[model samples]
Target: MIKAYSISLGALLLGLVLSLVFGSDLAFQRQWQLISGVEPEQFIDFAYLYSLLPRMTMALMVGASLGLVGSLMQQLTQNPLLSPLTMGTSSGAWLALVMLNLWVPLDIADLSAAAAMIGAMFAMFLVIAIVGIRNLSGLPVVLAGMAVNIVLGAVATAIILLNEQFASNLFIWGAGDLEQNDWFWPLWLAPRLLPAILIFLLAPRVLSLLKLGQQGAAARGLNVVPMFLLLSVVGVWLVAASITAVGVISFVGLISPNIARRVGARTTSNELWLSCIIGALLLVFTDLLANALSEQIGDVVHSGIAAALVGAPILIVLCQRQLRAQDQLSLSLPQSRLRWRNRYYGLAAFIIALIALLSLLGQHNAGSWSLAIPDAFNWLLRWPRWLTAVSAGAALAVAGCVLQRLSF
Candidate 1:
């Protein structure tokens, strides 16, 4: 626990230094003076003060909230791989916002947060329904979450694509930009997040009991159902708060708690606090790195994209390690009978081929459909879409295979 705290503090200091030094175009001393109200001249431009300081603050707060939520979620479901992203919370929120913008056509500033929270809660309930409260386990819950995430993602993407012009603003937000023009967002989010954090903090023993399986926890006089429900509400609310404040930033929850565990956060109490610290540090550093690259590239790189790039590999490594550990345990068990492998493979291949063929040959002009061989130049346009469909199908197939193996 001490080592984890030390490492987290070191990373926090490093991130703070980097953010102060390079987060803004101004000199370090000048930025400090502006921030501290030490210089009247430096305070003249409200843009620099509001944009830089608030953005950095928001990043830290959002990261910490996500980390807390992630820790709570992992404890609730006992699933390390499950986070807001994987569990459909982020996607559900995004989808709700998309639908609201599409159908309601109102000024969505105030409504977005409510919509996001509702969507997140709905997704949570759906997952609970799919994997019943009694069946709360890592693999089953994660599998249900994956299904919900896929459905929400597909719906959001389809809505955005169909209403491209209307969703132009949403596209940027969906990519998770942390660029803040004022302190309003940070001020808005802080009050909402504090309660969730407090709820989690007040229930450390409950969370610890969850580390014991449901049966064990029940044996110890823990009311598992109500506890899970409470944790789920708090976790989903934290995620919604972050999503509404910024956008859908994936994998912070997964990365933070796992890193905390690696560094020696053994108990739920230690993991919760250390995960928040590490998560804040991770986002601050990632945002700093994005800003640095943006200066050279002459284009802003979203921190969320950078995080996904970095976090995806980390997730792969974690999954690999988990699989290896599971394999060792499974080796001693009787081998399960493999069923319909060839039939499933053939069906998957056929679906991919059919989708690709339709994408390539099928065309609609002025609401009339036609199947024709396109010219060479036209084929180039169609081939990319066909290839994308094929690739997506292949990826989904691979994911299903992995999920099936993991479940077993």
Candidate 2:
């Protein structure tokens, strides 16, 4: 535990130092002076005090909160793969915020947190209902959560596209920008986190009991349903708080706990604390990296995109490890043909034909429709978009296949 803490703390300090030294155009001495409150100049001090400091603080708080939430969620669901993104909480919160902005004409800053929390809770309840609290195991829960996420994401996308003027800020926010103008976000988020942390500390024993499974927990006199619900609500609140603060930083909750466990955090308490440290360090470092690259990448190097780029590979590797472990205990089954395989191929062919037709012959204006072969330059310009769309569809199909196999 000490070693883990020391390593994470050291890394965090290193990240902070690097960020402070190089994140801005100012010299190291001037940056230190500004950070230390000996105001070098009005603009430099204001920029450092308001933007850089608050952004770093937001990264730490958001990362720690997400880590705590992830640990609690994994314990509650007894599933290592579950997180805010996988459970549809982020999309749900995003959808709710989008609706609020679309419907309400007033400034929404004050109401965003409550709306996000409500949305997260709704998404959680919907997933539970779809999978059933009783049937919370294996592929069904993940599949149900994925289904919910897809639907919510589609709705959110539609809302954004339909109301582009209203959703301009929201679109950037939903991509998880950690750049802050002041300390307001950290100040707002810090107190809300206390209750969730208190609940977590108070429920350690109850959480440990959950590892025994629902039946075993009930056999040991735990009120399985209420306890599960309570933990879940706490988890949802933590996720909502983070989302409200940082605007949907993905996979921190999923990555932190797993990394903590791998690094020798044995007990739940140790795991919780270590995960928090690791998560904070991870996000801070990622944010710093993003800041370093922001000039080159423009807005593409936001924290959420960085997290996904880093986390997705880690997730794939973990899934592969689990797959290997499961493969060892294989039970042979009778070989049988997939009766609908030919139909699946036919469906794919039909979809390809439709895409080609749309790309080559579809009318751009309502008044006139015509089919004509384009010039080489025009065709070359159009082909990339068509190819990208087709590739993305194929990738999604492949992802579904991998997920189905992993679930088994």
Candidate 3:
């Protein structure tokens, strides 16, 4: 516990320093100089440092909250593959927001978050229902997540088709930008977080027993079903609150717990605390990078999309390696199962042709179902979306099939 606490403090301190050095203050030096009417601090300065507090506080709190939730979730589900993102809470929240704005004709601008929270809970319920029915394991969890993600994604696409403005904002938000427009952080997160932390801290004995297995925990007089439900609700809350604040930051939950495991933080208690620290550090650093580079690139670049671009690939590699390791333990599984195979090639081709035809067929106007294909780069910019979708869908399907075969 001491060691974990020390590590947490150390990481937080380091992240704080790094965040100060590289975040918005550094990125927008000209603006700061214009505002402060003085030379900017190289590493730390009192003038602009006060401004960093809110952003830093939001990042740390959200990161720690996500980390703890991730650890608790992994412990309860007994599946490292499971996280709030994969479980469909974030996507569900986005979908809920889309629905509220689309069908209800209500201005959810002030209250969009409430809609997201409710949606996240429902999404959590759906995931839990799917996984619970299958008796729970790595494969079931991953498959269920994939299914939920697909469904939610389609719903989001449908919503976007209806309202392009909402779609545009939703897309950026869906990619998970942590920038705050107001003091919404403390208002939304603080109330639930304190009590959740207390509950988790007090329930360590039960959590430890849970690591043995559900039946093992139950044998020890812990009510597995009720506890699972409670943890699921808390997990959903943490995820919803964070997403509400930051707009769907991906991989914090997965990466934090994995790093904790790698660092030999084997106990659930240690894992939980360590995961929080690591998660905080990871996000603060990522945000720093976002601020630094995106500022340089200007209007053409997007920080949220950039983080997803980098983080998604890293996650893919890590997950693949882990899957490979799992496959190795059961040597009888065919090596063919590990190979990359595309399943949606044919479907993707058809979709691409259809879109191309529509693009060609549609009249060039202000707005219509016909997408205005640029005359200059018609082949270049237009074809990639369909091709990319097909390629990704095919690859995922093949991977799933392989994993299922190996697991069987």
lDDT of 3 by residue, 127-171 (tens): 878867434445456657768977997888777877896456767
Error of model 1, residue 345, in angstroms: 14
lDDT of 2 by residue, 1-408 (tens): 788889888998998888777766778877777767785566767888889889889888888888888877777777777778778898899888888888874857878778888998898789988877764544446557778888988998898899897687877788888988998888988888876666556567787777887788788999987887787887788888788778888888889999999889888788878878888888998887777678676745789888888888987776555443323334223358756676798898998897698786664557877677777887888889888998998899999788757754
| Residue lDDT tens for model 1, 25-45 | 677777677768864454435
Using TM-score as the measure, the top candidate is 1
State every prediction's TM-score relative to the real structure: 0.81, 0.80, 0.72
For model 2, the local distance difference test gives 0.80
Pairs clashing in candidate 1?
none
lDDT of each: 0.80, 0.80, 0.70
> Among all windows of ten consecutive residues in candidate 3, which has the lowest summed lDDT?
324-333
Better of 2 and 3 by lDDT: 2
TM-score, cand. 2 vs. native = 0.80
